[model samples]
Target: MGDYLVRAIGYNGQVRAFATRTTETVGEAQRRHNTWPVVSAALGRSMTAAVMMGAMLKGEDKLTVKIEGNGPIGPMIIDADAKGDVRGYVTNGQVHFDLNEYGKLDVRAGVGTEGFMTVVKDLGLRDMFSGQTPIVSGEIAEDFTYYFATSEQVPSSVGLGVLVNPDNSILAAGGFILQIMPGCEEETIESIEKHLSTIEPVSKMIEKGMTPEQILEAVLGEEGNVQILSTMPIRFQCQCSKERFGAAILGLGVKEIQDMIEEQGEIETQCHFCLQTYDFSEAELQGLIDEINA
Candidate 1:
């Protein structure tokens, strides 16, 4: 199924929930980055959660999530917009490790235990909203949950999962976030916690053909009244292009362009998100140099 996410309200608006299916999106990132199993799981989980959070905003709004850990996988960085477009990259996407004691991907080992997870939201305001917290666990879900509670001061439950194929490709990837809004009843909080602990991993549910709505239903229960707000397609999208990159070269000044023309005869630039490379001929570099001088 295609990647998508939904936002909804349950229990008469006291509980806000989000769910997403990101298998294809994660698969694309895995192939582009050539990440190993553990690295794929760690990065995929954060991208899944970031894309869903991006859905919480209005037009033109965007958010950036950063996982600065001291592990072999290095830092994880993701950018998502209100339109369900997201792109991310890891400092070390080729890190791998043996399965954990539970036989799952060693996300904790790949992500490291000492670091911080931060989210910066650009709401098109004078000051962007920012939240951050030390890593409670290198497991992405718990870390996100802690970020919400400690930084945003919102009580929330997060479940993020990514299942890797035997060959290190992404098999399934998805997650959910259920936040208790102000004035939520005690019973509602208890009910959600009870159900969350028993549900299967989010990736497993997505692998079983469950939609985003189904994931919410499983978490909120089949009986609760859930009102869907919006549904949007989610994918691995990067906003980098040759023209934009050309502008970057112009920023390096005219002499640098001349230096490149002398040294390499051409220039090559690569996008980290998709790993796509762009080449400019010597003439093109000369043109940029003229523009920079002008």
Candidate 2:
């Protein structure tokens, strides 16, 4: 249907896996950001992986994925929570390049290899968890695989893909994460590796209308080894609003509001994630100032 993900255990709990279809979600991002082909692919791939990582969290937990590479596309930031809500934006959305030798969008050329992928997890604890790893591959998927192995000590296989149309809209976007649990048998690893080597690209599978369950089946085999745990609906959702922004404005104190009223007469704020603009008139600013005085 729209956009959703599936979580499952394969090989009798030896491996935990996730798969998601994010065509619509990425399409929304493309429209919002007006990203060129390569930029769209990079942002979509990061969003796809971040949402699956989000699913790994529990209640009220959230995470931010940042890719700061020394490339034309600049930095990309994605925010996702345990409830399947996600939103992101790239610093430079209008970047594209010729296809690579593989005849795929040159995401690596646009994203650059000399940078870091940082993940910050807000687990509702006093101390948040943060991990940083080098961007081994600007292709996005392999970079995350490396992050899990080197930073988190989890051996994981990540497959992320995004296809863009001639009109620059998203054609297909999806991904899968397969993590080897502790005590996984060598035979199970070999079987999983075999399937991984032969399976179609995730974007092709999504273009073929494969559901997340089917993707997991393709990755983990079809011998009923994959036991689905649950499914979660996902979408590009931004947690920004006028009231929230107004509260933030109020936090700037009465003097700041007065300065804004004197300088601009009205205040306009734009959300970096969704590009939604919010305006506060002089009267509204005065009211906030009065509240601050009160």
Scored by lDDT, the top model is 2
RMSD of 2: 1.2
Residue runs of model 1 more than 4 Å from their true location after superposition: 125-127
175-232: candidate 1 lDDT, tens digit per residue: 9999999999999988888898899888899999999999999999865588889899
lDDT of candidate 2 over 29-66, digit per residue (tens)? 99999999999999999999999999999999999999
> What C-alpha lDDT do the candidate models reach, one value each?
0.91, 0.95
Cα miss at 104, model 2 (Å)? 0.6
TM-score for each prediction? Answer: 0.96, 0.97
Q: What's the C-alpha lDDT at position 204 in model 2?
A: 97
The per-candidate count of clashes, in order, stands at: 0, 0
Please give me the total number of clashing residue pairs in predicted model 2: 0
